[model samples]
Target chain A: MEDNKIQEVKSPSLITTPSGGWGASVHVFAPATVANVVCGFDVLGFAVNEPGDEVIMRMTGKPGITISKITGDDGRLPLDPAKNTVSVSVQHYLQSVGRADVGLDIELHKKMPIGSGLGSSSASTVAGLFAIKTLLGDEADPAKLLPFAMKGEEMACGQGHADNVAPALLGGFVLIRSYEPLDVVRLPHPAGLWCAIVFPDVDVPTREARQIIRKNIQMKDAVTQWGNIAGLVSGLFMQDIDLIGRSMKDVLVEPVRSMLIPDFYKMREMAMGMGAVSFGISGSGPSVFAFTKDEETARLITQKLQQHLTGLKIGSNTYVSTINDAGPRVLG
Target chain B: MEDNKIQEVKSPSLITTPSGGWGASVHVFAPATVANVVCGFDVLGFAVNEPGDEVIMRMTGKPGITISKITGDDGRLPLDPAKNTVSVSVQHYLQSVGRADVGLDIELHKKMPIGSGLGSSSASTVAGLFAIKTLLGDEADPAKLLPFAMKGEEMACGQGHADNVAPALLGGFVLIRSYEPLDVVRLPHPAGLWCAIVFPDVDVPTREARQIIRKNIQMKDAVTQWGNIAGLVSGLFMQDIDLIGRSMKDVLVEPVRSMLIPDFYKMREMAMGMGAVSFGISGSGPSVFAFTKDEETARLITQKLQQHLTGLKIGSNTYVSTINDAGPRVLG
Candidate 1:
């Protein structure tokens, strides 16, 4: 394989080279992220170890861009460039960078389940935009690329929230200051920290979950929420594991959202009792996640949660994951 | 100076000796602290260098407590130990530890002006409790002592607020997570940080200030406040000074409180333009505090604020200070 030539051609459009083909192809994988990590609400998120999406982009001779392949979504994803989130994101980025005429064929692998509270859509969006940027060479920075990819997430969630996308794209615990100019800062992630995420066979529409919440909250509750967030942020900085556990509490969002999850209270208590430091609904959930210091505790808590749900006769899929450091990577 | 004799003074009650008595006496100074550093609302606070109070507790004759001398407040402070905030706090701590009947004579030297937005009452309470604890050979732990002192503040503010008291008791940047169990955490204070506190001649009584706030806040505003708080916490942890400045905004409280401070908008803008990392009303203000990177900037910002007020024909007093690491110490 030539160093500059496209490798592992999976898209039909790439077979015939375009007029401006740089003979280079790009593949990007963005890790799955867990948003609203318990008390973190809108400010906290971390990338997960497994279950991510991959996107490959190649300069092509096709009249217009096309998503030739999208596996793992049961053929539900759109192939036409304009109707797809990934394609739309890429288009936005290209236009921003003055490269709108660049033609490319893209392939997306939806490895994670959609609407799973695992930042599935964000992963795909990040993966697609990242791949296109890689193929276009280093013409854009991650900060510039983020808003474009986040627009894809906005399509899924109705509003663009970067709590999940930022971490998935940047590969660490990220704080999104604002989505306007897309201000984000990455904080340190402690080593050996693993999270146990349990996705029960239940679904809660994000819109419905958000609707149950009050449009206005008492000023007192707001104060409490900010206090918890402050503690959580400080906990991460000091590396005080116990403080981190204590700080992962949400008074504003979880009470309303938890009603949608089965045995939410019991599962959270069980997790904590079984050595999980903290537990909260993952994003706008039917899924819940908990943090543990070690794999043994993670496994123990996972088993405890599974046992609690046995009466419901529903199987729970559990994943014990370390923090994903490499958010997105190229795979040829 | 006998160790056993000091041990016998189990509570503040046992330190009834006058200031000139033969028994050893301890005078502790606790600096005034700015609580709720803007976005932190109820969670963040840092101790300031200037305008601190002195508490002088000494052994005396009778086994009954008396606030022997109150030099500040223009002789308005209650001389009765039972009525004073500091003495009551000491009493509470003693009772909590099952040593409530010790006698002492306490002399409070008020260094900071009351109602100056410098946590004058909290400093007095912390200094008194701390001095008595030290004189009795008790290990002074602010975390354990804050709730007791907070009760005294409740008498003054009509509520127990740890924003100021926590930092005054425990030096550095402190977070008040909860008041029920009095959970507080001391967050890291970045190096070379200095605060310039400007006290314009005005008074916004804490009680009246509390009345002006709306009981209900729009959920949108609450979320923005929490996001900013999270950013502020992340900035402090990552030592990203720029983010810290951006996050110090308080959309909920400052807008309402700023009305009470003369020329607040102009002062804040001047401070920020002058390179203040963060600026906000210092606790139910009439006083405003701004953070800078160095002593030079601190001095420059203070002078700038003074100049701004001069232009407005509003007299203002400003003090340049570093983060007070020693919260409360023996003055002698």
Candidate 2:
């Protein structure tokens, strides 16, 4: 609460405390994620740049949790640390390792647009818990923090899914093989892979986007989706971009979600015409992303999409960048 | 009509052609395949050794197909090469290249069981077409031979599926992602990965085995099956044998078809106990396979399975071999 406005740093370093240990005041940054990447439906995701969230934490003098500050989100996010995803995720982490009583003051810095289908909540959920885990000198796997992120994200999106959260936390390409045992596998990231993400200025909540999808998909379509999923994973591991392009076909969820996004068909057509390897919804709907092989092509694709949106008088923001390999880390 | 008895060779090399121009009497071998491969239903398969089929072929004078002799099948298979899977496959290959007039007198060698869920027909389908492809000096990719194999396999089993035929022709592990464009991805095989295949004395035709499966499966079960399929592919690529073991779970087809196999549960239990990474029905029923990391373990598992079958008074045949990496190679 002292320096209420701790300026967010593009390049952050760890803040050393009196103990001079790894667990002091830490600022962790988590990147935005693109889930349901074409063929991957609730199983595949990758982290992207530009829009993300940060969590600030410090070990408190007393032995309980406190929410000191949460900036930039307006009144959209909850104030109570118990009710917030950031601190709640920390709470879940602490409880899991039998350290729930650890005193800490939590802070949230929101940079990404909320409910934009860009894994905004997942970023906070990942960054918040990640900051505390580092501060507490916990050497456990970063993936161990994913379940907490999933729990925290459920409060924001009304679904406890790991696809977006995994990529937001682990970075690169992540595949959630099974949910029952919660098996997540990190796949090889192809070189020179660029992404053009366009978040159309529309308030399509994650809940509404999910509701549009049917409960039961056709068996044939499911076969196609799963086949593409296997092929997608294979292509990435084999480092074959052509196979990746051919495999990134989503036949199950995209058709239904496209109805919710305005001019979704045309938007995808323009992206595909510009030689995007894959073009489809990022997570659920509204926010669209396209994968390309080169950065220049990604930039051109982004500009074309923006120009088309400008012509239609629809407000939109586009981010052109490569897939983020370093997911949630300290940036000073 | 010369040499009705063409002696089969074990350590066979490439068959020398007349004038070294590729067209001469040649023998090609296709290993028996394990289709379905636990979780990949219609999309995954791998080849095993022994109990396979062979095709002996030579160019004909009148430019018309003929089946001179067939061994071991006991008249169940057709005498007409056009009707036989081996010759039918050659016919498909001929029509595809607009060289249907290129005739071949053929002989079939049925080494594998006829209808015991061991990919007997698939072996014939692959070897027959492969022999002709080699004899005609067709420089087509081995993968291009799959559709013809599918055509031939269909005649033998009354169902056209490349799951078995692809692996039989190409060898090792094969993933058929999509059938429309016939996208088949050959996966990496872990070194020393041995297969213990036990063909119990039972008659379960490929058609009847397929008939027992429900047309429309529950959506929940489909998700599980596809998830495991993706996991299996990933495991093979990453060379994570434990992950492969965990992912070899089949939730869709195995449960329904296991009813036809005697002591199916007990067989899997013994195999799993003997350190088999994966154990399940090889293709349809009666024929069971277990994947092990070493040859010694594979032998032990096979012995245990054979003993169990013997105790049950069920006649059976067992074969232990690593993945046949050299698929359908030229034999001298």
Candidate 3:
């Protein structure tokens, strides 16, 4: 029956047929991202090495898309292709390329925790899209797929911003210059710069975390925020680690969002006291990240933070890695 | 009697004596600056080569400060030592160094239009400070005098911001990362960038220009503004001219301030249509500026803008130059 179905696929392009047949499969891994980057709010983000997501996609003869499996999400994610971010985003990408008739099966493996404020959904969505792109032998730039990935983000969260998906797609530090035309630029950074991310096992809903932020910020505070944003970008371009640390300050969102995570201030003090260069809440919070100059310090700070979270009787996970310079890669 | 005044002075530092006498004079030139730089608001600025001010300072045996002459200001500037920005700022520097009793005479030559929004007062104040520093053989870094220069800014305008004074004193493009501790850093830029400045003969009081701006802005707009700020800084660092042009957009202040300048939108259209890279209000702005790649284009844009202002029955002044890498220099 499956062989008979293969005959019905009308001329799947030669580029899509590696073995001159329809059962080609590809696997891809996409890095998780940290958005806002302290003072940047919705304008800045970066990719990290660990706690990412993997997607396996295979071409089928049927004229539709299906999600075969989703793991490590504790049944929190929807299995329906209509409701799932990965399948929905892949469908969007297919339609965009005039390949809506292509049939595929997707499997999302969440290597990271869900709702950790570590861009888990963005990672999954990017991974799925990357897998499909790889399977179809598409030669388009990965950044060209960003808009489709952002659609998945819009479905996962209420607002459609490129901060998370951009870094996750392009790698390194990314500055979203504008949203109207969707301008995103990759910035330079110090080679030795490292990030220490700790995801505390606290549930801070994305909607409520966003709602807690002041929509109407004071003009003076806004000036301070932009100053730091300019400084951070300058620091990155200059490759001055100390300046980057000094500029990693948030006067708008963190002050309010920090309240959602228990012992947030104490953890920050500990991180700074342990020689971390800078500290701030990641994404919408419950997860937080600190920066350091070397892998040793990054690991030490993460261990210290995880210990502090344990002292508060809260479970936590820790990861220490330099910035992920390569966004995504074919695993097999 | 003239010789008797020198004997009355208590042991002055030998560094102050250049000709083995109490009488020494120094002349200095300080360039004008463009603050806000479009999207930067209060955090970014850069120096320009033309339309600057000159200060001539002469050490005297008398035990007080005096403003001996002022020129080219249409008698709009004050000659009183206590009231004038140059003399007032010089006094602050003198008091800081515990040399308030040292006698000096200052001559301010306003080479640029007064209240042109081209940082006229900042150029004058920086010139005076530079003149004093050079005359005294003070080998300290020129940036150390920024606070003294900022005092003159506070006296000229109500607020004390480093956007103008920092670039005027430090040269090159500058970013004021924070105000509390006054962190200012110079940024690198492409060598070929040129500016076309046009100061229309009109009044747009700095205080009123500031007052007209919204005190509280929507978070979305602030995000957009900071995104552009980051993009501009990154563009400067990357030496990407088109990126810089695309990022030189102001969502907060320019909307309100443009109303003050006649035919502001039309002028912007003309400049942009004529191959200008970017255009915006230079400071609080009766003065406007556009950036171009070469000297010829800069001069042509300025000429065209002046003609447009002339069509409106308004008088104007125009200057064209590249970014000023040297902030202030000793004339003699």
The Cα RMSD across the true interface for model 1 is 1.3
Model 2 CA deviation exceeding 4 Å by range: A1-24, B1-23
Window of ten residues with lowest summed lDDT in model 2 chain A = A1-10
Ranking by DockQ: 3, 1, 2
- Model 1 C-alpha lDDT per residue in residues A118-229, reported as the tens digit of each score: 8888899998877876665554345456677778877777888888888888787876665444567676756868899888778788778878888988998888877777
lDDT (Cα, tens digit) per residue for candidate 1, span B1-332: 01100111233333233344435678888999887798877667889888899988876655667887898789778887778898888888767766555667888899888888889999999998887667666653445567777888998799988889888987888778765545677766677788999988777898998889888998878877877887777777666677778777788999999999998898888888888898898888889999999999989998988888887787777888888877888768
lDDT tens digits, residue span A1-332, model 2: 01111112121232234354423688889999999888777778999876889888888767777888888787689878779888788787777676655788878899877877889899988888778767766665677677788888788878888888988888888887788778888888688788999988777888887777676666567777777888888888888877788888877678888887878889889999989988889898678998899988889988988888888888887888888887898864
Best by DockQ: 3
User: Whose DockQ is higher: candidate 1's or candidate 3's?
Assistant: 3
Better of 2 and 3 by TM-score: 3
Tens digit per residue, CA lDDT, model 2, B133-234: 778666656666777778776677676778888888878898878887778888887887889999898777678888887766665677677677878888
What is the DockQ score, from 0 to 1, of model 3? 0.77
Clashing pairs in 3: none
Candidate 3 stretches with Cα past 4 Å from truth are A1-16, B1-16
On the 0 to 100 scale, the lDDT of residue B244 in model 2 is 87
